[model samples]
Target chain A: AQSVTQLDSQVPVFEEAPVELRCNYSSSVSVYLFWYVQYPNQGLQLLLKYLSGSTLVKGINGFEAEFNKSQTSFHLRKPSVHISDTAEYFCAVTPTGFQKLVFGTGTRLLVSP
Target chain B: EAGVAQSPRYKIIEKRQSVAFWCNPISGHATLYWYQQILGQGPKLLIQFQNNGVVDDSQLPKDRFSAERLKGVDSTLKIQPAKLEDSAVYLCASSVGLAGGPPRETQYFGPGTRLLVL
Candidate 1:
């Protein structure tokens, strides 16, 4: 079985400021990682994913994540966040050969003006 | 392309009542998924369907929950004698499932149906 941990329950940031949401996972086999965002009253949307090659993966809305194999981390980062970036972010993991995704609790990104 | 679609964006029912949710996945998508999202928590997979056939339903509570996708395109999930704990957002997602391809396809999600049990 696989599990995900998002230590931060909430992250507060000012508009145009840099932000990073941490995500870590535990899996015995190689896995694919993904980050999804959910706005108020909306469903989860894929932000980015890390499957194979290139440890650094970029996503929509100028967001990006770096897959640190040794650290077991796939932290989402944005150079400058906008007010619209305020949403709930979820991290998910699935084994390389499987399609069942295990998700983390989620991190609420609060972007203020 | 259109994303996934779910019905009754918001539903409120009393405890022990029965509720059902409808979902229509993207055209041509062979895989569909149902997830439950509680407040302040990430979405949890309740079931996965591969073209009208169930692939996984291990986490679903069979005593109260039941789901079916008879046509391989649309699906319905039902909860009988619901409990307060069943109050959550039910999300429907779909992804392209090509035979002999990697299983890492990106899943597209619907707006979800919010179920509140009073």
Candidate 2:
């Protein structure tokens, strides 16, 4: 079984400031990584995914994540955040050749004006 | 393309009551999924269907939960004698199914049905 751990449950950052949401995972074999964002009263939207590619992957909303195999991390980061970035973020992983995605608890990103 | 659709955006019922949720997947999609999401937690897979046949339902609580997809299009999930802990959001997702029968695939989700068991 695979699991994800998001160290920070909440993050408050000033508008236009850079922010990072930490994520770590434990798996016996190779895994695929993903990030999803949930807006208030809405379904989750895929932010980015790290499949077979370069270490750094860019996603919508100017967000990006780096796939670090050694550290087992895929932290999401953005150079500048807007108030609209306030939402619950989730880190997810799935074992190679498996379709079931296991997700972390979540980190609430609060962008203050 | 139309997205997955779910009915009864909000539901409230007492413990021991029964409730059912309906979902209509995107046109031509052959794979459907049902997930349960408790507050402050990510969604957990309850069942998966390839067309009308179930592919995986290991996480579903058979004692009180049931799900089915007929005609390989729309799906329904029912919970009998619901418990207080059943208060959570029920999410529906659908995929194009494995192209060339590949195992891993990405999924598109619905808005979800929020259930509150009193």
Candidate 3:
């Protein structure tokens, strides 16, 4: 079984400021990592994924994440944020051969003006 | 491409009542999944289907929840005698079910059905 942990339950940042949401996972086998975002009353949208190679993965809305295998972390980062970036973020993991994803509780990012 | 679709954007029911939700996966998608998301929590996989056959359902509360995919296209999930804890958002997701394929890792999700049990 696989599990994900998001250290922060909520984060507040001013517009144009940088931010990082921490995520860590536990699994016995190799796994794939992903970050997803959900706006109020909307479904989740994929931010980025780390299947293999190039630990630094770029995603939409100028967001990126670094996959640190040794640390078992896949933290999402953004150099600059906007008010519209406020949303709920989730970190998910699945084993190499399976598609069942285990997700973190969530991190609510509130980008303020 | 059209994304996954789920019906009844919102539903409210009393305890001990029955409720059903429907889902339509993306065209050409072979894998469908049902997930439950409690308030302020991440979505948890309840069941997964690969072309009308169940691939995984280890987390589902089988005593009160049941789901089915017919003709490998659409699916329905039913809960009998709903409990207060059953109040949550039900999400439907779909992905290509090819083993050992690259893009199979991505799963598109629907808007989800919000169920509020009183």
Candidate 4:
């Protein structure tokens, strides 16, 4: 089984400021990592995923995450954020051969003007 | 193509009452999933269906929760004699399934059904 941990529960940033949401995971086997964003009362949308080949993966809405195997971390980062970027983000992990994903408690991002 | 759809965006019920949530997966998709998301937490997978059969339901609380996919198109999830702890958002997701390996395909989700137990 795989599990994920998001370090921050809430993050507040000003518009145009850079932000990073930290995520770490524990899995005994090879894993696939993903980041998803959820707006208020809405379903989650895929941000990006780290399956293989590249450690740095980019996704929609100018978001990117890096997979560090040694650290077991897949932290999401954006060079500049917008008010529309404010939402809840979740990190998830699925083992190499598993179909289901185990998710981390979401981190709320509040981008202010 | 339309995204996944769910019914009864919100519902309120007293303890011990029964409630059901419905989901319609995207066209041509062969895999479906249901998850329970409690406040202040991430969504937890309750069950997974490949076509009209069960895939993985190890985490499901069998005594209180049951789900089915009829005709492999629409699915329904029910909770019997609900408890206060059962108040949460129920999410439905679907993905395309291929042969010969794990279904590593990306999934699309529907706006969840929020349930409140009083």
**Clashing residue pair totals per candidate (backbone < 3 A):** 0, 0, 0, 0
By DockQ: ranked, best first: 1, 4, 3, 2
Candidate scoring better on DockQ of 3 and 4? 4
Residue range with the least summed lDDT across 10 consecutive positions in model 1 chain A: A94-103
Listed for each candidate, the true contacts retained, as a fraction, are 0.80, 0.45, 0.59, 0.57
Compared with the true structure, what per-residue lDDT tens digits does model 3 show for residues B56-101?
A: 9999999999999989999999999899999999999988878664
The CAPRI category of model 4 is medium
Query: What DockQ do you compute for every candidate structure?
Result: 0.75, 0.56, 0.63, 0.68
Off by over 4 Å in 3: B101-104
lDDT of 4 by residue, B1-118 (tens): 9999999999999999999999999998889999999999999999999999999999899999999998999999999989999999999999886653334578789999999999
Cα miss at B98, model 1 (Å)? 1.5
State the displacement of the C-alpha of residue A13, model 3, in Å, after optimal TM-score superposition. Answer: 0.2
- The residue ranges of model 2 lying beyond 4 angstroms of the native Cα positions read B100-104
The better-scoring model by TM-score among 1 and 2 is 1
Candidate 2 chain B worst ten-residue window by lDDT: B98-107
Q: TM-score of chain A for candidate 1?
A: 0.98
- Docking quality band of candidate 1, CAPRI definitions: medium
Q: Write the per-residue lDDT of candidate 1 for residues B75-98, one digit (tens) a residue.
A: 999999999999999999999877
| Residue runs of model 1 more than 4 Å from their true location after superposition | B100-102
Q: Hey, what RMSD does candidate 4 come out at?
A: 0.9
For candidate 2, write residues B25-114 as lDDT tens digits.
889888898999999998898998989999889999999999989789999999998999999999998888965331345677899999
The lDDT per prediction is 0.93, 0.91, 0.94, 0.93
Per-residue accuracy of model 4 over A1-113 as CA lDDT, tens digit each: 67899999999999999999999999999998989999999999999998899899999999999999999999999999999999999999999878888999999999999
